[model samples]
Target: MKNLYDLVVIGSGPGGYVSAIRASQLGLRTAIIEKYQELGGTCLNVGCIPSKSLLDSSKYFSLAKNNYSSHGIFFEKLFFDFKKMMDRKNEVVKNINNGVKYLMKKNKIDVYQGIGSFKTKNILFLKDIKSLKEKKEIQFQYCIISTGSKPSCFPHLNFHLENRILSSTEALHLKEIPKKLIIIGGGIIGLELGSIFNRLGSKIIILEPMEKIISNMDDSLSHEMQKILEKSSIQIETSLSVSNIFKENHEQISVFAKYHNGKEVKFIGDYCLLSIGRIPYTKNLELENIKIQKNKKGFIHVNDDLQTSVKNIYAIGDVIGGKMLAHKAEEEGLYVVEHIVGKKPNKLNYDLIPSIIYTYPEVASVGRSENEIKKDKIEYNIGIFPMKILARARTSGCTDGFLKMISHKKTDEILGVHIIGDHASDMIMEASIAMEFRSSSEDIYRICHPHPTLSESFKEAALLNFENRSIHM
Candidate 1:
């Protein structure tokens, strides 16, 4: 007899596990299949969770070592033990991973360990790894594909583990910090990992094919971040094409690349990190039999409701591909499950979704940026307030970067908000909420904000838009 489930979610990533729990809550017999030995997928295992852990540790280390004197706090010969720091991050990740397993068990979601493929629209084939046993089939009334993605490795680049060549995954598990590190691709991963190591006293250089890192973001925003990174002594080389990588000496590797101006430059480093981005990990899914459609980039094609070509099968998160963020995937997973349970659900507002980069003076933004409004030829009024003008910033001694708001010139409705400074990620959420309610700049300005707070910057920016009068600025 074949096992049957009301819902079977393939891939145990954030999207898959969350949806499985929701299905179980809705009184459906649900099962989840994970190819990896670990339960929490890449985000929990290596990507988001672990990276943030390291970033937080590194930030504190940098601050204690360098800025303590200015804050009127003194610690002679301040130091950070790399081994201990990494161990703490690992412990945090392990706790979270175990918590996910507990949720699956508590929710009564069956977990199958191994690769899964679709046999029919409603049937799934599971391959057991340990005994090489094959499960004939399992039937499901509804399916969710949340296979997620993996880091892209260049075939031509010889990634010698012994020589300290690493991908973002391996970089996170480093035993010793490199004296000099050369990173390929200056997108989110490269910039983030680079920043962590850079703060730990590593000389870093980033190579990018585009004219700027974070090319999808607003040009001005990227410029602001570049300046901040430069202050940390990190170098960025844009519009550079890497020709080849070779071992120059017994101790160092030489990377050859051409600059945007067609000049060849050589870089020597103790280690090279590849942060080129990720491709959807759909290789073993055997997508041919089910005839599910995919985009040109090999990401599964889904409708506005996130339903694939097959009506009952849905795809979300990195596999479906928009921002490739864990939070966005969780939202989609919850929405799909609710919709399946006969609840009238609202579609995800992609516009209000915030993007955060956890470098020094973290970057966060939501809604359309000034660049996007201009590109679309929309008329908007812009208001800006520097962190230097905020009393909270002065107290924290992190008075760099600013908050900017974009609103409709005629309607005064908030269009976009961007922030690049301390606690930017946390502060951007309020702006996102305001925009979601279609609040105008005047409405935001009228709100009572406590004096001598970082949050006051939001009110000041809005006031600048309402009238040319911001009290602090």
Candidate 2:
């Protein structure tokens, strides 16, 4: 007799592990498989968690060195230990890993430490992660593939992971911060990681092929963030494409690129950090065996219900190609499990999902950007508030960003919210909740926000939307 399950979720990431736990809660026998020995996928292991940990540490160091004197606090000699910072980050990650293990045990979900492959629509084959040998076959009623993604690299910049070259993964675990760091992409990962070393006293240079960093957000955000990065002494070169990388010496790397103005550009650095992006990682799952339909970019195809060509098999997270946020994956996991138990869950709202960049002053948004509204030729009202005007922001000594709101001109319903200020990631949730209930700008303005807090910016922007102005702004 073979082991059986009502659900088998592959990857054990935010999507996979969450779905397996939800399945168990619904009284379904569940199992989860992961290729990595430690759980939490890239988000926990090497991506979000570790990166944010370093971001936090670097932020504190930056504040003590730069802003502490403004608050009348002086130190003889302030210093940071890179090794100690990394050790603490590892501690935070290990604790979360234990928490995930506890959840799996609490739900009685069997966890297999190996890669999962499809044997049939109703059967799964597990392979040893190290040896790549088939370990077992399990019968399952349904399966979910949530194996996330890997860092994307360009052909010219590609090299073996070693001392000089690095992906975002290797960037996190570098033994020493490079003196001159040249980053090739200016997206979320690039900006966040660039800030980390820039604050650590590195001469940072960022080369972005696009016109702006975090270009997917509102143009205002892109412009404001660029100013902030430049204020921190990080060089940002936009509209430039890197053509080649050459090792000038043992520790010197030269990068060659073409500027949008048709001029050749060259840069020399101690290390080159590649933060281009990531792609779905499913090449080895033998998805071909199941004949799963993937688009041109290799993301698995799924219907509205997240079901593949075979209805019993579902796909979610980065593997399925929507917004690649961890929270997005978690929500989809919950929805799919509820769906499996004959419960009709609410549809996943990709638009309302908040996207965040965890820099010193975070960037977060939900619903739509002004660019999207303009493209559709919608009548909209806009409200913009600078963080410098807020009392809380001034007191905090970090007033380098702003919050903008967009609402329907006639109906007054809030269409989108963009924030780049203190606690923007946490603050955006209020907008998310409001948008979830279809709250109007006037509706948000009516709600009482506490005095001398960062959240007041949201309400002020809301007031500016319909009232033509705000008391503070």
Backbone clashes, each candidate = 0, 0
lDDT of all predictions = 0.88, 0.91
Per-residue lDDT for 74-181 in model 2, tens only? Answer: 999899999999999999999999999999999999999887888788888888887889889989998998999988887655644464878988888888988999
Candidate topping lDDT: 2
Query: What would the per-residue lDDT of candidate 1 be over residues 216-312, giving only the tens digit for each residue?
Result: 7766678888888888999999999988887776668788999879899999998899888788878767788999999898999999989999999
Regions of candidate 1 where Cα sits further than 4 Å from its true position: 129-133, 158-160
Residue 434 shift from truth in candidate 2, angstroms: 1.0
Residue 124 Cα positional deviation in candidate 1, in Å, after optimal superposition: 1.1
Query: Relative to the unseen true structure, what is the C-alpha lDDT of residue 288 in candidate 2, on a scale of 0 to 100?
Result: 81
Pairs with backbone N, CA or C atoms under 3 Å apart (clashes), candidate 2: none
TM-score of 2: 0.98
Return the top candidate by TM-score.
Answer: 2
User: What TM-score goes with each of the models?
Assistant: 0.96, 0.98
Worst 10 residues of 2 by lDDT: 154-163
